[model samples]
Target: MADLTFTKSTGLLAWPAAGGQWSARSGPFGLGALPSGVYAVGRNEVTDYTTSICAAFQDGTGNGFFVPIYPGFSTTRGSIGGRLGIHPDGNVPGTAGCIGITEHDASSFHDAISNTPANVSLTIEVR
Candidate 1:
């Protein structure tokens, strides 16, 4: 299991002691901003589009919740509720309350975690 952190203020996602930093900018949440707190990145899965890696977020009740990160999609893609994961596209409005990075950076993120066992626990802290 790998623990990751996302600092909303700086739009940075990082693994402690990891070599590089990744971007994870969040989208608007409801009438204001998405609640800032800790979230768990559940089981990792391949996106339906087959262009990025994804994982469900566990809510306070430990149930799968929110949109997953889909860092491989192009900038043109938009959020589609639970059907679509968060893409790395820069357009914040398209995120729909999910974190985003860039296709190139997402590929690196995938490689970083690919070696870990399936369903490895990931912690995301939105500050």
Candidate 2:
């Protein structure tokens, strides 16, 4: 059996604009440490101006699944500071942001996500 790990941390991340991209360094879950099909659930857009809770994951590829993990489907603005379930492959499938997982140098990507001042709660359960 593969070694599975579950780690949790708290910090903030900045969500870039449509043409921009941002990343968070969740715990010590390195780049390749997390399988390509990993899932992420937490707050996305955060700011005194805007906020949102989002859940996203991949299917062993870079294609990601994203959804509004907040109030309702119609509600698109809010902030979430709580424990989120991050699974390599969640038991059930639903609507969420699924993005292609890219394998990169762990050392380089580390601390990239939580480097922002927006403070958040992050959890990464690896399998």
Q: What is the C-alpha lDDT of each candidate?
A: 0.48, 0.26
Residue lDDT tens for model 2, 19-50: 22223223222222222222343435321111
Minimal lDDT window, size 10, model 1: 56-65
Candidate 1 residue runs with Cα over 4 Å from true position: 29-33, 46-49, 52-80, 83-86, 90-94
Instruction: Assess the local accuracy of residue 109 in candidate 1 as a C-alpha lDDT between 0 and 100.
Output: 57
What residue runs in model 2 are displaced by over 4 Å at the alpha carbon? 1-97, 106-110, 120-127
Candidate of highest TM-score: 1
Prediction 2 global C-alpha lDDT: 0.26
For model 2, give the 10-residue run with minimal summed lDDT: 46-55
For model 2 the TM-score comes to: 0.21
Error of 1 at 72 (Å): 26
